[model samples]
Target: MSTKLKSVPNDFDSIEVQPLSDIIGAEIRGVDLSKDLSPAALDAVHQVWLQHSVIVLRDQRLSDGDLVRFSKHFGVLDFGPNMAWQPEANRDHPEIFVISNVVENGNPIGFLGDTEVDWHTDLCHTDLPPKASTLYAMEIPTDGSGNTGYMNMYTLLDALPDDLRIRLDGLQLKHEDAHTLQGELRYGLNEGDLKTIEDAPGPVHPLIRTHPETGRKCLYLGRQWNGEHRATFVDGMSRAESDALLDEIWTVARKEDCAWYHEWQAGDFVMWDNRCVMHRRGPFPSEMRRIMHRTQIRDTAKPF
Candidate 1:
């Protein structure tokens, strides 16, 4: 007897999927961000992103316009409120978030004077978080530094022993907008700027979130920090006991193989699902330059 198998489509002229790793990201080749993509091409890219959780397109050659256009294909883009960098871009393009350690005139912004960011999903403090985020690398550091690292929450869930998975089922945690950055307050975010974030009420979500698209469970601890609370006894445990539980879970979640590190290069674009991954940026030299433009896609569904 003969068996037939379906083949992956290779019809799109604009996009190509090349696997970067067996478990995480794919490198999409032959795509120019400047031009609009056909529905077929867009669908193809979306399918791969869902399957891989992260996708990197090299040599994208994006302008601000291109960044917005490419991002819109996925969903409505939501630019994060300014607390980090490029406040001007936040004002002009409501859909673009600029990530850079350089001045507009091509000068180093000096990392020593700036603050480092921690691992967290974009907009997780809000009731509605982003579905995915795309960052375009415009000028990368020369010394192979300033790489972004991503941890796969899906893998985190998979790695958990059966007993732990059963333990996390139906558990909920509170995510809040507590101010952790002292430097941000010192830099003078006005009442209006601060109010925008202050109004963001904390949300409660399952400890193990099931992806609406893929229907797979993922560990959903957005950022394991204080001020965020978890209910331990259904009636909820004391803050101290809950925090210790989270610390234990985080220790298990952060094993080295569950993460992938991407060294940035000029014209590299990285996009990942906020639902199934958490990311952080590494420090680079104070005198080196790096600029990145980001567009975030609003989450379409709630994490039950």
Candidate 2:
């Protein structure tokens, strides 16, 4: 008998995969998340997600059931503790985290303020920040506004000068939930809401985080509103200096080529890796209506 085993057939040759943009995102056509996915198909999806930090699937036509089924294909899902928009969904599905501006009574709550949302990763203050997040647009504003922007941190790191990259190696930074709370309260968080936020413990992480899957180092300086905690430095710099340095970092990171903007459409599902990317929501008219459902994937690894 021959020592070599018989050749096995590959089933993924039929799937259609295409990149959305050269630098960041991809669109995987012809895969139905509603149906049972073969191991090969799941592997293909995983591969693309790793390659392109963000993936957009147009016309997914996913219902709540479809969304839940699709999310399970990735890893364990995380329903955030803080309430945002849909409380009923939270109660029914522990896997899906809701992000919306609508109240329980079907009234539209406009943006918390007219100001812009700064650059930040989701759930960074938690012990296990979300690995990925998926947002489905149910309704988009009529005006050509409310664009969601994303930055490819991996590309940003690649563009950095060698000296800066070397300096950021093994640096840590203090991440607090206080700023998020302040934003909420500034927008009118009630006493009960404030209590819930206070109970959640804050976490610290490396200023330059290493992607567990890709093994790439990324700038992890998120949006800061309150300046209370100590700095976690990788280059042995003081807090004030670190803050100034971060401003310089943002100047490079927020360049047009390093980022992509997505104009929302109904039934579009947008997913991005929180570990290696930062996102921001654009300003939209307060009078117009916009609603979106978000589900965040749980991070299996502990916070660095």
Candidate 3:
């Protein structure tokens, strides 16, 4: 029996997907962010996203609703953590969170001061972590000091030695409540017993989780230190042993080769798989204005 190849649709020619790096990060050209995407365009985006994990679209503008609407196409929209919000962001659009260093009339507009934000997945402290996050730049420093960096956990796990991979086969991470992305503490939280997984301030998930859609495993590591509680140890491992192991893993996982950093422009929008990538930001001058709006997508499938 002979099978004929499926023909590519004519509309698919309108979109372009280009890899930004060898492992992660791709740029999608020829798509407008301000307008609604056609069904064919959406499917093209979804497929490219699954293959690249991180996709960037440039030179387009989107409002709070537009960003939220675009995010909903991929998964359940997560309005983000319930906490205090900037008056501007809270007035009508609580679903969209601001990430700016701009202050107006003695009030700071957003979170993350002009300092380096350590790498961590969005909402890892919660029982259900968001599957992905979308960040749209409104204004960014001309100097490009606040470039965002992403680490591909799929390759990070694959590059691990066979022994380390085997050893981490079934370990679960005890994630603790760090401050919110806006860098605020969760209400009624305390820094207590991080040594025990059950006692940690937040949820515990498998260190190596299989992606529900792709079935590919990625290393699910969060930040080391942040707020009252941090991920202190692996489940069923002593503090000393866990610390030693994490140090070794981070040594390789945090390497420069494992990451791709994106410098922001006013109209750049990036969507990344939070479940399979850990991201951080570089420090910028405090005097400069930098603004970004982010929407996170909630998880439906449990990490195995």
Candidate 4:
């Protein structure tokens, strides 16, 4: 898509807001996230995020407490998935989720180690998924590893084929909670927990969900693993039928026209709306080390 200029909000008069792409991302300059933002400035950032879906602030040096404090301006904090296994520094802050490839004492310092994470929303398996997610870069590989990409779901929905749009009107999907995005079973789960995708335990949500705030409808394909027993599929449909439908949806959703990628910098901070966007990470070399701290904003209600 081509780039276009958007008028900055009145509260953004002191900050420099630059659009990263036509559809998805914006970079906000001249703001110190470590210090508390004025109410007007915080609202200005929120407005930019609502318009762009994702916002990046460069050269931000934030501690775990600073990250939590800034993220709370958006909404209530949600506990990270690895709260039980947090590193020493993060043990005091359960809201901080560590994403890293570093191994210390023969144990990973964080999750999603060095592997490419495919397209998916954050915690969609839950009945009430997060409204937004934030990530702060601490250490990054020198060889340009771990670039993150984001897709604009609203634009994707608007450009959907008529047949597919019609098919999605009333369809609901089961977001499988049995496995992680990397196709591994979650902690304390076992093979006996789920026998088939048909009977898997998870949240049932509309295939196309309306954003509670924006009131815009968008496709919500939680995640589909490449295996005979997939994680997410259309609810109540036969396995074959659901697979065929999902295959069609993926063909359109995976198009690069509405996507933007961000290369990580040591002091970069990124926050994205989980309600109307999907994201993925590129795989990095195993020998490289990348450390990132993340936080999620809790949603007040379940998706309709």
Candidate 5:
């Protein structure tokens, strides 16, 4: 456990923090985010968030502005690139991205339509990825689908084999920028423009990164998948070699013991640290509906 979490100041009077699981996530009770909060209250929430890696607040209604306001307290807001479909979906609050399976006027109203989103850190292909992401559930399928899972990277690194842990130190990974978590080519990128994984455009970041604030190291595998285009590869290593090592790393990461899944409630709001966590979602029934409002917090510095 983080020392900060263990020594949380007892000055908080407005909220109570309860651990959701031994691994990650804390449920915060007794605060309506729509209304302004005291500095101490926000500080308490922030501290718990850093220690927990993921935090949940339930049963509160918030507008786009309210969500953005609360998010700005943590860091500068990042408005993700517009999706190929429904480019105008967030015109009112560009910072608030929509995630949904709903279709309207023959066009999808949001991104990542009702499928199982693979594990990944948001925008890791960029030079500077977001520090964190916030999601608010507006509508969820009643059939018990679309639960989101989070993995604690700190624990994952500790769980690695001793030899593998030492071997991965000081290495870097090239994050491929052309593909989305859904496996679709991003907008304005031509598939024919790149022939090899080496030809892909994206930034390279340390395979093991130290959290800027906490200074704790964590494995930073941006993303991986089987296909023609290598989603990510290690620096100074052959594709085959990188693939072999990644296979081993991912095997440990996928262990059911290192993860926690959140079942959605209509008014649930979740915020997770993108630096030390990887998240994925389960597929929901196509006939059902799931709508979410999301915001990303920009990292002040590039990953070192």
Candidate 6:
């Protein structure tokens, strides 16, 4: 067990944080995120979040304001690139990025449009990527669809092959200017640095980043692929060499051993550390509906 998680005082309030998976998630019980919390309660929640990279709060009925306030407890918030993609109904609240596939009156209601969102870190293309992100599921499909999966990069990096670790050491990668999780150009990005996949807007991040808080190292491959194209590249390596290397990395990174898939429920709120975890959404039926509101916590420290 991580010392970071143990030795909790018996007087730690009425909080209970239970492990959801062997590696990645924890279910936070006995707190309603929609309301303001006491200082002690807030601290406990924050610590639990750090100890477990991803924490799921079930049955949360949070409004945009509640979500933002709850998210701000950890860090400043960011209206990431996804904000611009929100529909008119959600435009007034840029802090809330609407994720849905529902259509009404001939227009769609939100973003992510019923497709498989490949593995990625939110705002990885930005110079200052957000530190964390929280999503409140409003409505989910009746059938098991749109399951979001999270990978424990800390464990992933720790277990990496010696040869691969040595190769990735001291290396950097330019994460693709993320237009979308599906790699489509985001709204109003065509004329900017994110014009094409080859020459798009993205931030250069260390291939192996040391966590600012924990000082733990993790593989930070931010969205390695966009469709069939290489959305990222190992700096200083030839295109063919980078691609070959990335292919091998993906072979290990995408393995199920390091992942946990979340089956969504209405009012289930999940917040994950963007710094040490990469997440993806499974494909869903276009006809079925899935609505979620997401908020991001701004980054404070850069990856080393």
Candidate achieving the largest lDDT: 5
Query: Which of the predicted structures, 4 or 6, would earn the higher TM-score when compared with the native?
Result: 4
lDDT of 5 by residue, 92-175 (tens): 788988898898888887888887888888889999999999999999999889999999998999999999999998999999
- Tens digit per residue, CA lDDT, model 4, 1-304: 3232333344344677788887789998878899887787887789878888999999998989999999999899987766344444536788988899898888788888888888889999989999999999999989987899999999888878898889889899988888888888877878786787656678899989999888888888787554234578788888889899888878877776778999899999999999999999988999998999999999998988
Cα error, candidate 2, residue 290 (Å): 1.6
- RMSD of each predicted structure: 5.8, 6.8, 4.4, 3.0, 3.1, 3.5
Give lDDT: candidate 3, residue 267: 91
Candidate 5: where is the Cα deviation over 4 Å?
Answer: 1-14, 80-90, 226-230
User: Model 4, stretches more than 4 Å misplaced?
Assistant: 1-13, 82-90, 226-229
Over the stretch 27-88, how does candidate 3's per-residue lDDT look in tens digits? Answer: 98877767777777888787778878899999977988789888889887755433354333
Evaluate model 6: give its lDDT.
0.81
Indicate the TM-score of model 3.
Answer: 0.88
* lDDT (Cα, tens digit) per residue for candidate 2, span 185-216: 33443435434322433666787778898887
- In order of listing, the candidates' clash counts read 0, 2, 0, 0, 0, 1
In lDDT terms, how accurate is model 5?
0.86
For model 6, residues 248-269, the per-residue Cα lDDT tens digits are: 7888887868999989999999
| Top-TM-score structure, candidate number | 5
Task: Estimate TM-scores for all models.
Answer: 0.81, 0.80, 0.88, 0.91, 0.92, 0.88
When 1 and 2 are scored with lDDT, the better candidate is 1
In candidate 3, position 148 carries an lDDT of 95
Question: Between 4 and 5, whose TM-score is larger?
Answer: 5
